[model samples]
Target: MQQREEKQLESALDSLIQRVNDLKSSIAAMIFKVENEYETLNWPQFLDNFALLSGHLTSLSKLLNHDKCPPLRNLTVLPLNLSPERDEQLAQLTEGRVTTFAHDLVPDYLRTKLEPMAESKMLHFEQKAATVTYENAQKQVAAYQKVVSNIWDIVSKTREEWEVESSSRGNTQQHSSVSDTHLLVTAIGMGKGLKPNPNANGAPGQPTGGMMVPPQGRPGSAGQGPIPPSTQTMTMNKTPSTIKTNIKSATQIHPYNR
Candidate 1:
């Protein structure tokens, strides 16, 4: 009797795994639908359905290997995945269209009216599966979706930060270059209006309508005698040399110029 029961349990397990695989395939269609509009994707509904399915699979696997219910290791690499023949058998046993579980062995009358028992067993399996699914299925659909969401968020945020920095750097560089090339005009007093100032420091300005004139000397003009072009050179600043540091910071230029 034990042997028979064992055989039945094994057969049921095989069928369950196969069904789960089919469920996985069906899930692809749902995934496609969700991908189209992920914002409105019914995550709770999807999670519930997926959890129910995984729970069933985990339950079946546990039932098949009931002797080892409390998994010994943190990473229980099922040997079933390593064996293609068993995998094929599992696929065949679970598919409703390809079920080879010999339903004819049971009485035809019992088979004809088994929905209640079948539903009960299904509910039981799903509940068990949910438990096992939580324990065994290392990567749930929820986990997968979370991973994708996190990656997208990271990528978007990184792009935004990079763009902001890039724009700021460009603006800074543009302002620096413009300031370097731009000239500021100041007036220095001179002997006449058109020529160099005999008293001021920089360029002269217009005293009247479209008329340039020498700047007037002040009472406190101590170092204001030359009005030479060289006096204005001290105030004008140049662009710093460290502007291109990032592009070639790591580069090495040998003494031999190699």
Candidate 2:
């Protein structure tokens, strides 16, 4: 039973170790993929892909519980995104459709109107967001690695402890087996000492200690002389009647159905 339990523990530990390794490898691969994919996309596509990657990082961080890793995007600055209608109006203005169509019709006015959009959608802004996202993801990967390493350390320590325990238990069992063997040998030696001699001139049916042996009789007639066969048969036949009388008396008093 102890050996079976040890095997089960070893299996569980091995399974956990494998899972941790797989998680680590998966996180590393994903980080590499995100870095590679980020390099080729323009700002819009890059931002979208980064958002998806950030979601995955958030989920992985939650699973691994990495407290040191911060949020992927900054929250201190309020978002500068415009409402859909305002965004469409701004787009129309940029293309010189909302108001007038000409050469720099409203330079200062256009700069004022487009400033928030520029800050929200420009290359520098997106790059900054991407940088923060990538940094946090890297931190998450490091944290995940740390978690995996800690788990491996725990498994190693547990395996060492199990080995020590198993060795001690084996030693104990070996000592017990030796003791049992010694006891069996001693018992056999004692039995030999008490063994009766077959060549002794004792009474025909007497035991080695000179105790008179009883003749075979009824079952309850130990130490008695043997009864006649007819009498033994009669005694055996009376037992069933006595049992039936007792059972009837018991049932009348107990009245089981009532």
Candidate 3:
């Protein structure tokens, strides 16, 4: 019975080791494909493929160091190059770690001793797997955040340029409006034909100005007379008492208020 149990244990270890070798081959194939297409592969697709490959590799690692068997850090025929020191190097490069268990290469002959060792290794593997998964996820998240920050930077720069262009356009429009107003004022002063006359229809056959002033009494009319050139000069020359009187009169009788 003891010999039969030992044979069963040996069979289970062989099967587990074979599975580990198969997984390693699969991971190697994936790695080769990724390396070949490193320049041309779509990043998001590659990330997904890499995630699947890593998961399989993780499974293989677990099997190789299974509690029922002795821990093996390096497989003779596997391409993973798995070792505690190498895993640390990988972690530095990929922001990920492939954990390994350190133990004797041969399992104990006694079932009592082997079973307990296996259970302890299993628990440790579970904890390590959880930690590795979380750390890998964090690295991926940070990579995604960097992309987001770059996009936001581009958007911010575009907004700044647009604001600058809009301000420049507004200034140009303001200058154009002032130029048009100045030109209109000059033409009205120099061209006698463009003068405004209030009593245009008073005389038959009398020469009238080109633009007739609109009659008063209409709602919202700008009053009966054109502003004289001397009005600005008179305002500039006003005494303090005169300016105060005008301000008082304007406050008492504003057209908008009335």
Which candidate number has the best TM-score?
Answer: 3
Assess every candidate by TM-score: 0.21, 0.24, 0.25
lDDT of each: 0.56, 0.61, 0.65
Worst 10 residues of 1 by lDDT: 76-85
Kindly give the number of clashing pairs for every candidate.
Answer: 8, 0, 1
Error of 2 at 105 (Å): 60
Clashing pairs in 3: 67-118
Tens digits of per-residue lDDT, candidate 2, 1-258, equal 878756655665455455555555666665675688666656776566566656665565564444333332332333344232335555564454444323343444434345665766886777876777767989989999999999999999999999999989887743357767877786565543344556457654335542333557555565666565687689889999999999888888895656
The predicted structure with the larger lDDT, 1 or 3, is 3
lDDT of 3 by residue, 82-113 (tens): 23343555455433533331233123321234
Candidate 1 per-residue C-alpha lDDT over 70-111 given as tens digits, one digit per residue, 9 for 90 to 100: 332332222222321223564565454432323342343224
Ranking by TM-score: 3, 2, 1
Candidate 1 structure lDDT: 0.56
Stretches off by above 4 angstroms in model 2 are 1-134, 173-193, 197-206, 209-258
Error of 1 at 9 (Å): 7.1
Residue 77 lDDT in candidate 3? 27
Q: Which stretches of candidate 1 lie over 4 Å from their true place?
A: 1-10, 22-26, 37-39, 67-258
Q: Cα miss at 228, model 3 (Å)? A: 43
